[model samples]
Target: MSSNTTQMSIVCISEMKNSKRVAVEEEIIGMVKLNPFLYERKHEMYKNKCMRNKKFNELGKKLNVPAQQLKARWRTLKDKFFQEFKAELIPSGSADEAVKSKWKWMERLRFLENIYTPVDNSPCSSLNISKTVQELQQNMTSLVDRAKIIAEPSVPKSAAQLFFESLAKQTEEAELTPAEFCNLQIEILKALKAASIPNYLQMFCLQQI
Candidate 1:
């Protein structure tokens, strides 16, 4: 074949491949829209299968592709199909507003699931505000304990004296009450004395003070 004819043939073949890919993609999307549950179940299966196969690096080497690239493409296709299926679940506006609102909340939950850690591994698994608050309180307590260790050994006499003196001057300027002034002095003592304490506890107490 002549050079120009060969080039034309190659272009035609490439165009045909592109057209075929587009058609297949559209068909998959249509199937997902028509039967969301089917698609979702299939997607879940694929996700489980992918996770079970831990030797992705070896597989990629055999396939002559980067493992990261293969995994990324797989994830993209999986997410695309999943989203298409979810979109199908949205009812028409004519439906009851309450039903629609419920569906909207469900969709939000799905979105959050995709973005956040899975329930099994999540830090906030219980999804209870009070539980989360309790966890935070525990963490704060631990931090305080660590800080106390770090802050041990009182501040040098000279530093404590200087800090108190400075505080007294400030208290006078601000016209603070005795009680408030005493609190201020306590804070100063903690800050100056904390360095002698252990690293972990010093930070915790200093922060609270």
Candidate 2:
């Protein structure tokens, strides 16, 4: 096989293995949820079994054999079969049904196991693409807002005076009653305060009247 093809196959196998691990973890969690007492009693046994299975599967995939093939091979061994059979035969409640459902979901998840390659090695992967795009957009928008502030032209004193004069003119032209003007001025003062601007500017503007 070509190097690229081999690399792609390895990536596929790695992803499949990860999916299987996740599925197995989910199954264990489901079993624990269904029978917390049993899980607590056999916690160490379950932990060791899961770790051994995960390691065996990962090694098998690295060697190019399917994870299921490794599991099948292990199942055929006399000792493995005896242990598994004994575990299965142990008396238990209806909790096995929940575990079965979790395994069924895992089986479905296997269908998506090879959907993407690792992000660092492959640009074509779509894993978490939407989240990446949203984060990039937010960063870009923040950068643009910062740039606008940094590039803003300084306001001349005459321009400031003219701007306020125009605002006062517009307020008068609105034909507001004395009470309405007072309310508008109060709102303007509040906005300035909220923006952390010195109150002296507002006081000066008001005093000009």
- Which has the greatest TM-score? 1
lDDT of 2: 0.39
67-154: candidate 1 lDDT, tens digit per residue:
5544554445545434443333322344411122333223422432233222333332322221232343443343343332333457
RMSD of 1: 20.5
TM-score of each: 0.25, 0.24
Name the weakest run of 10 consecutive residues (lDDT summed) in model 2.
Answer: 122-131
Q: Which residue runs of candidate 2 sit more than 4 Å off their true CA positions?
A: 1-157
User: Model 2: per-residue lDDT, tens digit, 33-134?
Assistant: 453332232234544666556655665555555556544443333233233332332223534211222333334333222222123322212222212323
lDDT of 1 at 73: 45
lDDT of 2 at 73: 43
